[model samples]
Target chain A: MLSSSKVKLIQSLNKKKYRQKYNLFVVEGIKNIKEFVFSNFLISNIYTTEPIPFMQEHQYQIISHEELKKISFLKTPHNALALVELPDTLPYSIQGIQIALDSIQDPGNLGTIIRLADWYGIEQIFCSETSVDVYNPKVVQATMGSLARVQVNYTDLKKLLTTSPIPVCTTDMDGENIYTSCLPQEAFLVMGNEGNGISEDIKSISNLKLTIPRFGKKQKTESLNVAISTGIILSEFFSQKEKI
Target chain B: MLSSSKVKLIQSLNKKKYRQKYNLFVVEGIKNIKEFVFSNFLISNIYTTEPIPFMQEHQYQIISHEELKKISFLKTPHNALALVELPDTLPYSIQGIQIALDSIQDPGNLGTIIRLADWYGIEQIFCSETSVDVYNPKVVQATMGSLARVQVNYTDLKKLLTTSPIPVCTTDMDGENIYTSCLPQEAFLVMGNEGNGISEDIKSISNLKLTIPRFGKKQKTESLNVAISTGIILSEFFSQKEKI
Candidate 1:
């Protein structure tokens, strides 16, 4: 059972203002809750329809499915919902090949990119301020369990790139082909918005502009999706490093 | 204003039975509708808030925004909606590079792959019958009018792969590294279910099983997303072809 205040607080996290004020974000679905519970991440609270044996170590409440559903953002609520404490703000540190997304507006894209970045062992992702809110229910759901492992920082992309010493790369159609391009091992790979590519100011700061070559005879579609391109780029980076 | 009967009929397209019975599907959004209207697709009807200067050449109705929203499947209704005649069943032709999705459940992934396939000039996509219905309103919206261009067929993947002469290549964790794998210019690339990899029977038919090499120093995420994997594989196919 949940107190009225608890339920209100859980519901409040849906908005960015509440999330920021409370320094907390929502993570839902049985898999995600399990992942967060078992991970090193700190969970402020857990709400579920039934006893989640896996999350026994956390502060939790077994509420009715109807009650859980009320606070769930999904159309079909996953078995569990959790409030995770947002990490204290950390200064940007240019390390291994980190992925920086400039104004990626889609929640699903940002989440999937976080998952993809996690798989490649890239621990940090920086999203432009205009990017979809990471704590948006849709983004949290899309990240699956990867959100537990990846550190996502929302910052002004233009500022970050301009002052960076490491080479910055932006994906574009007219850029040098990615296949033959010499991508540095430790640098920032900037991805652009869904409808628009990288902005001019950001593009100017990009030390290199790369493209994934299209081999098919047809040019029916304008561009490869930003999320899709990230996968191909990450795949090539890993494959290249292994050979060396 | 849309007639009540017409509105009910459009909403019915949400179900599989209604879709097959009417032999029609819906496409929405400003960009999608504009592209869909201009593309070679047959527009059975169009519902809009205002007269589209160019679309005046076609059959359309200027309806209230509320009326347009009534039949819209999206959270935010576009300015227009179009009922398109489902193309005739295509003759299943086996040749060149192909993509097969097994039990994919996400509409967004289904749509993005359709767009990616069109960009790569891949002619056909085969999906396991259990996959999301290609004509689902969400899927149609996400395809960005590429649905009209690509030929999608849903069938039993196990039976199809077993009988087909084309080499079946699948993605797996412990498989050959894709960068060095000599991929056939013409073959069926099998992408598996959202949560599960290729089934045993499908794996049995695979001529090659390869993995996308990960560059991240730490493998933190559970798995690379299926759609992301599909993009990486398609890009590699094009890259290999370009080198040749």
Candidate 2:
């Protein structure tokens, strides 16, 4: 049986402040929990309706479905849910073609970007302080087990871009066509907010500005979704490198 | 002034059965409603909190915000909402690079695909009976404005593939790499369901099988999101054709 306070604490982790205060976030669904279990992330608690063989004897408590429902954040709660310790944010390290985000606010978009980063072999993602929390449950669920693979660091994006050693690449309306641009093997590709493209400050500092040309007959779409833009751009970079 | 029966009709339009019965669907938010107004779609009614300059004087009824909230589907209702006539499904015509969805269950995915097809200049989409309705409010909202440009038809997959004049291209784990493959200018590109990709029946008939190669070091990711995958594949096709 889940205690009222325990249920409250688990539910509170859905918000960023509480997640940071406790340094804990929830991971639900059997597939996602299994990925976290097998990865380096340390699991603090596990609540489930059935036995999870991989979890330690004392790690997970098999609770009734009624008890599980009380603590689950999902509308239709999966078989299991886990409380995981958030990893300490490591110092920013220069890497091959790192993705930089300037206030990407959507958790779903951030999660899809993280999964795309994992697929294309990009190891690190640098996010502005304003970006949505990577530990947000929506992001964790959207990653589809890739949250265990890709590392995301939240930092002051302007400072990072100013000091970066590699060329800063960003997408824009009138920028160089990505198909024709000589994309570097190692660069920082920056994406921006949903409503706005890359902020002017970031765009000014970006050494290479790329654009995905629109082909529609009427050409009315204002912009692509941040995550979809990331996927198409990464495909170009990866295809150019013959990496994927 | 809004009548109780009118509000009831608008609310009922949320369901597929009611939408089919009335041949109408709701278009909310100023941007999407404007797109429908500018397009060939016939508008049945417009309800708004204030006057819309572009709408005909008699077309929109200025209503109170409280009344607007009563009929709006959005969490925060936008400036306006319109009931639009659903276009009759025209007979499927052979087109340049048509998109075929086996059973894309997510409304958001279908919406994004419609928007992406607009961006790439692909005009027609064919979906199986199991696919979500294009008129789904979430989809209509997600499409932004591209719903005006693309056409979607529900048809039998097995029959469509058998009768297609061009090759049917679909992605798989062990297929030819999309980056190096010669993508045809005019073909039916099939993307599948979210969890279980292109059903076996469709897979057996795919003439050209392509794969988006994974380049991650550990490669733990099972697959890309259907929408993201569609973006990457469409990018390759568009780039190869120089359609932009």
Candidate 3:
């Protein structure tokens, strides 16, 4: 049985302010919640209609389907929803091939990018303060389960790029062709906003500018989606690293 | 003034049955409508609140914002919406590095794939009949303007693969590493469904199977999103072609 106050608190997790205020976020679906259970993130509460086999060892509250629907963010609510405590913000470090996002507004794009980073073994992502919150319900859902592994930090991107020890690469329309260019094995790959490319402050500081050359005859495809571009660029970077 | 019957008719276009019955689809926003206007598709009607500079020569019905909202599919209605007649289906031909989708149910994924194909100069896409309709409003919106350039066809994927004169390639988990493999200059690349990848029938018929190797240590990410995988594979194919 869910108390009205408890339901209110869970539903409020949908907003950034509430998430920050409570230091908690929502993770729905048994599979998604399973990832967080083994992760560093602590589970604050688990509201479930059925017993999750893997989660039998953990404490969980049995609730009705109707009760589960009340707090679930998805249109078709999953069987279970868990309240997860937000992980502590780890200090950003420049390691081998990192991703920096500049004002990526779309939650789906950010989530997809995080999943891509996880797939490519890029551990950390540095997002501009203006980028979408990593903990957004939509972003979390889009990540599938990669949110458990990928460490995403929101900070001043310009400052981070300026003080970087390695080369800073930005994807551009007229830059040297990505295929032909000599890509650095270790650098900060900065992806810009959906509507605009990289910010001027961030772009001017980046010495390496690479472009995924357009092959279409019309040359009318404005640009690839930010998430797609990230996948393509990351694949290229990893492929080049493997060869060396 | 938009008629009540006309509004109902426009709203019905949201469903596949209605779209098929009328042989028409709705395209919203001035930029998107402009693309269809210049394409092979014919325009049946244009409902707009503001005068469009490029559409000056074409006929359009002026309507108030309230009227536009009533007829618009989007939450925030675009300045205009146009009803574009479905183009005649051309016979599917095996072209250089073409894309084939097997039961891609998500409209956004289909649309993004179409746009990615346009970016890589792959002109045609053959989708399994079970795949989402290309004329779906969500798909049309996601394709940006690329829908105007790329041709998408719905057909029996198994039959198409079986009859293909060119090499048939499919993305699979246990396949040759894409980075190391000598990719063909011209092949039919088949992308599978979001959940269940390449159907057994399609998989058995494909002679060449390629995989984007996973680099994450945990290797927990089950698979990349179908659309993101398409972008990476397309980018790799083009890169190899350029080198050759």
TM-score of each: 0.92, 0.97, 0.98
Q: What is the lDDT of residue B192 in candidate 1?
A: 90
Per residue, candidate 3 scores C-alpha lDDT tens digits across B62-83 of 8999999998889999999999
Docking class of 1: medium
| Position A114, candidate 3: lDDT | 93
- Chain A TM-score, prediction 3: 0.97
Sorted by lDDT (best first), the order is: 3, 2, 1
- As for lDDT, the candidate ahead, 2 or 3, is 3
Local accuracy of candidate 2 as per-residue lDDT tens digits, A1-244: 7888988998899899999899999899778888888888888998888878776667788888888888787788899999999987666569678899999999899999999999988777989988899999888888888888788898888899999988899898988888767789878999999988788899889898899998888867758899999999989887777733
- Please write out the lDDT profile of model 2 over residues B1-244, one tens digit for every residue: 8999998999998899999999999999777888888888888889888888876678888889998899998999998889999997666578788899999999899999999998887777899999999998998988998888788888898899878999999889999998888788888899999988998999999999999999887856869999999999999887777623
| lDDT values for all models | 0.82, 0.88, 0.90
How many pairs collide in each candidate, listed in order?
A: 1, 0, 0
Ranking by TM-score: 3, 2, 1
Per-residue lDDT for B218-240 in model 1, tens only?
55457777788898888777666
Evaluated with lDDT, which candidate comes out highest?
3
lDDT of 3 by residue, A11-80 (tens): 9999999999999999999999999988888999999999988866459999999999999999999999
Q: How accurate is candidate 1 locally (lDDT)?
A: 0.82
Report interface Cα RMSD per prediction.
2.1, 2.0, 0.9
Instruction: List residue ranges in candidate 1 displaced over 4 A.
Output: A38-40, A54-59, A216-218, B37-40, B55-58, B214-220
